[model samples]
Target chain A: MSEQPTHHGDRPGSPPDGRPDGRPDSRAGGSSAEQPAVTASPSRPATSYRTLRLGAGPEWSSGQLALGAVSTGGAALFLVALYFAAGGFDLIWWLLVLVPVLTLSMAGSGMSLGFWALMLYGWFLLTDSGSFTWWSLPAAAGLLVSHAATALSASMPPAGQLASAAVHRWGRLIGIAFSAAAVVCCAAAAIHGRSLGLGPAAYVIGLVGLAAGVWLVRTNPPSQPH
Target chain B: MVSQRRRTTTERSLGDWHPTAAHARAVILASVCGVAAVLGRRPDLLVIAAPLAVAAGWGHLARPRAAVTGRAALGDATLREGGVTTLVVHADPPVRQADGVVTLASTAWVERKPASGIARLDDDGVAVLGLRSLRWGRHRVGTLSLTLTSAWGAFRVGPTDLPDLDICALPLPSAFDTSAPTPHPRGIVGQNRSSHPGSGTEFNTIRRFHPGDRLRRIHWPVSLRTGDLHVTSTFSDEDAHVFLLVDAYSDLGPREGIDGRPTSLDVTVRAAGAISEHFLRANDRLSLRTVGAADVAPIGVGSGNHHLRRVLDTLASIAPATERRDEGEHAIRGVDPMALCLVLSPLIEPTMVALAHTLASRGLTVIVVDTFPEHLVANPANVHESLAWRIRLLSRAAQVHSLTSRGVPVVPWRGPGSLDHVLRDIARRASAPRMSRR
Candidate 1:
């Protein structure tokens, strides 16, 4: 799901362990301590929805994806209103528009999580007053790329062929590219702003997309946990 | 304090993970609306989103821990030789949408979850995942990880530590060759075989005449002239020791049987169990050791329940090495001339066959329980692979015959059946050995 660099294959960083079982230790130099704590993952006869594993954990009373969207959208709206209220209609502000996709539209599965993208779209269409700008195109493009990178992350290889070197190399590149695109796009946005400072818009989108990207990698691509 | 038993622990997990997505959605929605109003200078909607988010998160904060538990029914630890037994794993977690799974520590049992969610005993839960028994021995039945979520993708994961059970599958002894003439002259009840040779069914050894020896005119003139007393040595008539050499080496074929039954090891273990139990009941001293570890791990030499347990434990602990080996490879081949030797193996390679011949040459009674049929014996697919597999099986079968011709009785049969039939068939076909009347 990488947008900018076009990183390839699933699991931006997962292909490394390359264990035939894709067990946590398939990672080289991994010790017994590093083995993902073994909690029973739903044994899917088929390889599809990488099962989400957590025993009802704690989070900010507000949901993560939702909270992030609200925080981000509200910040964007605030910045726009503050500018407008200050009688600054002529200000062409720089902003980032990233599609915070929790998962990509994978080839086989339909269970992919798109909460982040959905909320962001809603924020764009219904709640926010800020109009779209040509300057924001790259930011949105970068976000879409990040979504694709994540989709690649969840893109798993066949179960028996986990250790193939080709898979892991592509995975790492995808992860890095995903993060890099956001950073690089914002840099461009900041440099080429036709308005007042790429503003809070770029910063908010960059923060949410990057944060979600890290989380997606941390949870791992949607494959069976070893 | 006593930890009592559990009948169900399902209701606990679902109650815990029920709110995740909704809470997140509401918070984000409310925050968004609030931020919008603040941006647009409106506050009413933010209030509404906040309460809705709270309602969604209520169950997460309210639910208690240790809410889910399950009770599991166990299967045989020692499967009979040439037999199959389904390890019944019934988990009843006391919650709806409480997903559980079963796993084993033994690698021998190729674990498969063919059925997700079995509605009853027959259904395999590809839906919920089921664990299958692939090998014989003491196996631990432990908890499964379950994640419960709302339809909105709001979910929570928790542990459903189910009640655990241990399964012990014993190895199958090679079928007894009953017709090999029970070395005893009279095997019927009451005609006991004793070493003293006063009056018994078995003849141990002939020696110089002696006084106090049952003098039914025993060599009258020799007894009169020798003066010094001597007796013919003999032993108590009993079943000879038959140590079965199970070579859990390279498997017969792929792990799964043609009909999805189990591996040769699975059949071997079950057979071993039935044989051990049978010999125990017959009061025969039966010992166990693999053809691989025969030199060192000779077991069941002593008669009793203790001996049986020892063999069963060994079968459970023994990990079949995938590396190929032969009769001279290991220092563990247990050879005993006093007992009959039984080799229950698929003979995947010729080295194992050679090892059996070596054991038989050691003056021990030998028998081979042929499991080769489980592997290459048939043209399973009628494809090139199947044909090749068949050839490999045939060669192994030939090796069994070569050993048999050297005096070791070999029994060939199919699994999902009793191994005792091997013993009974051998007894029916083998002619009685010549005996001298005392």
Candidate 2:
């Protein structure tokens, strides 16, 4: 909780050391031997700065750092790939992926970034081919739209509304739909396959997504913070 | 009064120091880079350039003539802890932009809240920001740094200082005190010998004098039965006036201590504020004293809203001494005799104990409200000044007991419901009764 305006570093006043963060002087607030009962916040801290720091105390966990690294790394790597390939060089492409990658990169604690990453990569797969096959074009567009919708938990059209939906079940349903579509697309490619480079790499990554869907159903991390 | 007026001047004011011209140049360069990126179809260049542009634009927006006829308007100059306050920014020939930092000269905690509004030169050139809430005492919102620029971040000029802004934040009534002991003595004659008046305490009812009764207990009721005079004897509930002294030495604790940076002074301040309010509510005039240098007169003999305000302001501004081994010697050196002097402190020295005991011997009531300093524990391995700490605490505790044995009921103030009741009930039953909360 927050405290009153009068700030001493400790309950009794402050530390003898100039280090504001150091331990208090001897006999600071009779606070030894027992953890004081959590004092209720007198009031929300004078809400000044928009951002807050959850100090570098024990409260900061390694998991958070791990999440940030994973997110920023993923975005930077994919962005580099797209930049190096440098297709039509459309500025609009920046706008397309900007919201997802940037938002994901900035606030690293969420599944929202993962969903966007999936959609961006799906679009990248189709666009790089430079050939608009009837199946491929629709599949790419649907892939982006459905993935983004699932991420945002949105209902797009008149047919999309389904009341009484459970949050986890709804996510699983969407995953199954994507899995079906992916399996069909892969099967179609095999039927008239272009036996070429990086094709094997695409198949492997595709199987990974399919395997992840099953794992996600088994281990459900809550969408909200504990 | 005119002679008393100190000419307010700032030799190192924001007005005198404008940011170097180089800060503005950075903005121009960043903007040029933005244009280059757009022309060259380089999206990556644009990303790197935008933040730079914003930073540069910020400088440009901030730069302006530092000069202004600044008049600061504030909501309620006095504030209690956690009470909301507002500061209105106004300038003549209007500053193109209004922004500055608020520094509290005499407080443990205070903050300048975010504010936004438009200041049109053609219109009312005013901006308002909420100070929201503050901790305690009169504080000067001295020379705020202001940088003026157009809203667009196009052309920043120079930095100016907001002038003539000072405020007083009153101490708030605190509800947290978790350090009182229980099952206090009852039917007791407290340290203060002089009782206010009538009581139904330990003293028993008078009995009619019998023929063989002791001459000391010959009641008038019995005398009337036999048409003879008689003497009555019984104890009177004699309670005393308690003076709660708080050691306001600096270096007591952190500004924001383990408890949300609540300084040691903050705790002492809160304790003083709460106890004063409590005593005042109990129909007693409380005398507040802060030890160390810059000593102020103990809050005079008084009880009312005005008295509380005075105590709060005094407590709010109290700072710990920068020196070592000091107590309330200067503040209460020759103070009025206290019935019950409730001293709230860590008992940091033998002097504090000597002071309490000396007061108690004079038949002035003294109750030591210990501000527990033992909470400042940490590993000695990494600490530099680890030696000579533990020895100090033991000597101080001994000092407190010395006074307690002399009849001053030195009680450690623990907080919360039942214990507080016991302390209050015991005090009221004795002398230091508190006003019941409505």
Candidate 3:
């Protein structure tokens, strides 16, 4: 059997000779009486950017950075197409270019909704005032990709290195979202093919859409803590 | 006492599902926008609402219905300092599209991997966090909080803080060994040779064979020379009693955790563990007593490999602080008179110093092992503080000088061979003739 002795008395800051061990010494000196060997931290990958700045922890991996670049670049390309479609680039419109870049900081935040809303409003204004071209379809696809990329980046913590499974998952979702957009585009093409569509039948379609939306909301259950 | 046993993990259901902000946004945005686009006869507007509609529908159709319960556990309940362990958390009835995350709270002397201490749950809703202990003693591995967001971010189960779990991190004993013999050996079973002649491996002398002597004991060469049978006699192996008095009053130095340098308390605990291991491995009876630290439980003396484990466990339970009412009497009471007493401390407190004096005055073989860390004196960051320490240390030096004058050997604890020279010196002194004053 092993022995465990009863707790002994040693007050903090007291002198070891008279009082318990807790009292601080009357004379000056650090509390610790000895120095020990320092241990090295876990090593990082050779390509890590932690070395660039002192006191920095793990940062975005090369894969994450690349994904961000591609997503933002895709958004930029769509913005350029919209610029030409709207007849010219307005200075105010140029601010919208920051949307993709802002996604980096806005990761894991609700601000992505506002950014996407603003981008959607921009396209709405352009198409409502200018000619409605099929170009908007590709523009929607780009925006969707950017949104998914931001969400994917935010899914894990900042210090975490990129996991390929997450990237692939988000990519698949983006594809699905784009495919849905294509179906809407096909419906629009069909609408353009007809001329007498503003009848009671149109009102019936609108009512059905409203009812469908309500049913969807009712079927989904709210999340609650256990 | 609870820390000595491994805790079995228990879990409760995360509860019924509830809608989150993401769900509300998707549903309202899709419904209103899609309806307005249709009424306005704007195909471009419909295109804008297409993805939102899909998101809303997907969220509703795939909402998780099964209840989830999460369980967290440590890979090992006990670990040596600088040893690593896995902290795993798993959710039952895993939600396929759920985004689960587990975070470990920052703890003293423990280093967590990813620095952020966050890990994503896998497809099975399980996550593993790495924990490495930098110092000895009992400590909570930080708060293990869990959160799970269901498909489309529509619903959530929790961002709940789980019950705190504790780990007993044993001190990694400093490397130490000695070929020198102990000064006193009392028990029958041990490796050390005793003074008396008996059945053993070390040869003593040869004598005429007796009726009780076994045939194997006969020395052929001696028997042949004398024309008579002679038996070989050998010294007996015996075990010694070692009593360790540990001072746990002050914890000094910056606690940078496992990745940084050890503090004063770290040095003390590790040294105590090393000494216990050394003596116990020799099959010697060992006992431990701690002064200060109210939380530590009392342990009794014993020997063997199992006893060594108990010693390490007791060391892990140390929390630095002197009891408010104790005068250091009970710590020294009932100690064996023939036992070799080892006082492990930084000598920072008067109580431990007094205890050493009391043990020495009792005429027991007591040796004081200094466990103060060196960093305090080497790095003089603040001039005034350094000067103050210098003054206190000088006073401490006087106390040390007094101990030496009374014939108690004080030795600083270095990793290996730290006690070899002092133990040998004590052995020599014990054998020397001395006069007793009545």
Candidate 4:
């Protein structure tokens, strides 16, 4: 039951001593008689009994904490790959690294989206444009793991433990996504430093692919009842 | 307007496969990086974005199209205190590859199995949450809110609110029994010995045969010795009328529910239940009436297991101090004159004491069971509270003294064998001659 701080005079019909008959009050509702008054200090305000307490935050299960750790680790791995690609560590890396670790609790939120964007932007800015590095494979793995973990975390409450079936299903999907990245990395490495001299066709194909991707992700509008 | 907007948002979300933040993140990153790889001629970006694109595509393909609906049902609507029941949530046409979370809100005296009250749906899209009722009363089970996430957390459905269910928790009566017979067993059907002679198991006296006496009661040895027809007389078995008058005026002390120390009302109700059970099991007619609570229908005099259930139900319905203006005139208006009145109260309220006096004045054998919890005064929080309690208890003692002076026995309830000595005294008094004004 929610605790309500009851005073001697709180009840409407009851008298000051908690007696209904206007008699000098007794300890009826366990309410004490006139309490000894305390003077409030000048430096601090007196505490109000009516102040609402929101209680403690939601407790996280071990499974959820482990998943959060995995997400943070994945983001860290991506940053590490970026550092190796850049051939040096910058002070900005610390701020970038803190984003994923700090937002670990809210992995389901858009904050994670911002974290991924920053990591990918860093990779693009630090690495050479034309050359394909093998580090991209591990970086891709890291990004996928983080994304998968975040999705799983968002599916349930912090206190909810992931079921074994859900874990297996997500693990399988993650493997499939990483395999696709590996295939693409191998294809990119094969065509490195070699030009097939196909003019505006590549750009046209890329635009068509982008349009198709947009259509695939587009949500259908709610149907109106006739 | 806020609620309307929330409803609209919920409807829109449930109506279609809306993208989750994860889906948006994947799709946006894939499109941006894929475009950047082609536009800026960056092969490494394409390699990095490939996995995201595949994930986005896979999630979109696996998105659930059918609208899902959920409903929750309790395993049992009526349970005894401390009984466990399951809150099973069913999702119709179970959506495969979807993750579902059902959250049961925390309610007083209702303990959830996981403590967090969050249960993940099994593969079959059904979630079962265990609820243990710790106290006796009618309680609305916690609001069950369900949310379903499509595969890859790509699309979402409800954080939908399902209809609430109610569970009637009946009090588990404390162990009670008494070998002493109830006073004034007047009705025909029971196990108690009646004053009038008739067909029964208990021997009364040998006398001349009456015309209405059964042939089996005729005694051959008595007839031969007297040289006249005589028959064995046995006391008739009759049931007693027990009127349980529960005082619902004040529920003192902390409401810690059934697992902890009981408050005044808890003690009173449980004691009434135990007494009713004991009497009804012995074929005694029992009726129950509450003095101060509202909406508690008075149980009429009845016997057997069915009536015992009715008595328990009435006891469970009591909400303390809901009707403070009650003078208890209605509670005592139509009580059986021969009934033994058991007024269960902590005597915190003067109204109960007054009611007990009224019952005793009507010449009914009234016993006031003091249901006061002694721990209320023990280990007081402060000196003022303790002193205040001591003064209150002195006033309460005067009330008990008044009732005792008027020949109403006030006994403190102590579970099993609590009423034995008092009942024996009342029965003994019933046999003794006393002066009465005509």
RMSD of each: 17.9, 18.6, 9.9, 12.1
Structural similarity to truth (TM-score) of each candidate: 0.45, 0.45, 0.85, 0.85
lDDT of 4 by residue, A3-122 (tens): 333222211111112123422112112111311111111111212122111245456665676788788888888887777777766877856656665675676678888878878888
Restricted to chain B, the TM-score per model reads 0.56, 0.59, 0.94, 0.90
Q: Write candidate 1's Cα lDDT for A1-226 as tens digits.
A: 1111211122211121112342322211211221111212221222321222123421111112332343345334433433433334333332422223222222113322244334343334433343323323232332323333232222221111122342343344334433443453344345442454556786577556544533332321222222
Every candidate's DockQ is 0.02, 0.02, 0.13, 0.19
What is the C-alpha lDDT profile of model 2 across B1-438, one tens digit per residue?
101222222322323223322222223333443444334323333332333334333434454544545455665555544444555554545643332222222223444332211111212445444442344545565444333333222232233444555555544444544233211212233322223222323335455444665675657667787777664534443332436677755445444422344545666666676666555544455566666636455566666556766666667566557334564566556665534456777667556667777766776545676765444534255353323555556666577667656665555545333135435545565455648789
Tens-digit lDDT track for model 3 on A107-188? 5555656666666667656655423457767776766666555544554444444455555665676678778888887878
The CAPRI category of model 2 is incorrect
Clashing pairs in 4: A17-A25
**Candidate 3 docking category?**
incorrect
lDDT of 2: 0.42
Residue A28 of model 2 has an lDDT of 31
Q: Interface RMSD in Å per candidate, to 1 decimal?
A: 17.5, 21.1, 12.7, 14.6
**By lDDT, is 1 or 3 better?**
3
Fnat per model, in the order given? 0.00, 0.00, 0.18, 0.42
Per-residue lDDT of candidate 3, residues B251-335 (tens digit): 8777654445667788888788777777887788898888887766656779876787788888888777756555668888999
Mind giving the per-residue lDDT tens digits that candidate 1 earns over B258-346? 12454677556646655665555556666666644322354646656666666666665555553345454442255556555567776
Q: Name the 10 consecutive residues with the lowest summed lDDT in model 3 chain B.
A: B1-10
Any idea what lDDT model 3 has?
Answer: 0.68
Which is the better candidate, 2 or 4, if ranked by TM-score?
A: 4
Off by over 4 Å in 1: A1-226, B1-24, B35-53, B56-114, B117-131, B137-143, B146-237, B257-268, B293-296, B316-318, B321-336, B383-405, B414-438
Candidate 3: misplaced stretches above 4 Å?
A: A1-78, A99-110, A129-131, A153-162, A196-198, A218-226, B1-12, B256-259, B380-387, B436-438
